[model samples]
Target: MVTWQNIDTVMLDMDGTLLDLHFDNHFWLEHVPLRFAEKNGLTLEQAKETLMKRYRKAEGTLDWYCVDYWTEQLGLDIEMLKQEVDHLIAVFPYVVDFLDAVRSKNKRIVLVTNAHGKALKIKMDRTRLGGHFDRLICSHDLGLPKEDLSFWGELQTIEPFSKQTTLFIDDSLPVLRSAHAYGIANLLAVIKPDSKAPAKDVGEFKAIQSFRQIIPA
Candidate 1:
């Protein structure tokens, strides 16, 4: 549903857009809760309940995506924990072909993720997907989550692109809304972010089930 010739830059999210979200979903939902339960002397259900409440409180904030912040807050080495499950990191279907086609067409493909640097590096190292992008950015370095309007302006200061020619794809509706507000002309969402979970409801936005659907001409 995208007009390839009209798009100049292809900005993508990491966890849900370019990469399969199963790694992240399983990490937070199963792995962390299991470990937290063990450490805190609680049942898995209890740990999940407790952590979910805390996660909701931090949702959409930079702290939500901050490894250091979660490490300090949870009294856990969040980075180390992620490594224990790093083997699960994987790219989504047809992502490489999509990136190659876009690059071949000479469009600027950028990864704009909210993942902390450590988390970002771990996935990049594991998947060897770093070479596909023209630039990689973490909201932690920007000191604001993509959900914030200021993030767009701050992003432009460093990696400049015309808002009207940009195609921004993300699974997070809040972040997409912020991008829309910042005048990003083309927006798309992911139908299924977490492969193990049910598809997300992408209200009022166009979405893709696979990047294979939008490969550039």
Candidate 2:
């Protein structure tokens, strides 16, 4: 639950918050592995096992979300691969309505994402959701991931907002926890980030299944 009247800034995550995570989930889990297997002459299972291990190593770090880093590490044209599957990128249910509702109330909507610049451009090009935001930020620009506490401070230097009056919505619990630690008063979690996956059990934080749940009447 959120008090819209008290909130002035809405920091949204792109991949899992505004956009359905199915495309990303499938891209990394299925498509990437398949291509890696083909390029490396390994079996699909072997490629998945190898890539998953590497992914875990970079978990919670900016490298995990960097297309350039992955491209060099995996010897694949990561950006090109994303374009091949750009058709799958999609906005979630009622996201536009919620954006419109926030705009109508004159709230500042900022897309604060951990997505790499290349990935962000591809998604925004397909969805055209950039026009709805007051500012668009990629963690890459700040040289820090949203999971890092320092990122919040760096973000404030450019796009200022009261920590207590801002509502940060994200699908990643770790990122939300970092924001909480940085003193962001309002936090909301996406219960179901991936349309193809099951709902997550988010403890403590208020969770929403869709943006429709928070849209003002």
Backbone clashes in each candidate structure, one number apiece?
0, 0
lDDT of 2 by residue, 72-187 (tens): 99999999999999999999989999999999999999999999999999999999998999999999999999999999999999999999899999999999999999999999
Name the best candidate (by lDDT).
2
Per-candidate Cα lDDT values, in order, are 0.93, 0.94
Task: Please provide, for model 1 over 1-217, each residue's C-alpha lDDT reduced to its tens digit, 9 standing for 90 to 100.
Answer: 9998998999999998888889988998899899899999999999999999999999889998888998898888899999999988989999999999999989999999999999999999999999999999998888899999999999999899998889999999999999999999899999999888899999899999999999987
Q: What would you estimate as the lDDT of candidate 1?
A: 0.93
Q: List candidate 1 segments past 4 Å from native.
A: none
Whole-model lDDT, candidate 2? 0.94
Provide the TM-score for each candidate, comma-separated: 0.97, 0.98
lDDT of 2 at 15: 92
Which candidate leads in TM-score? 2
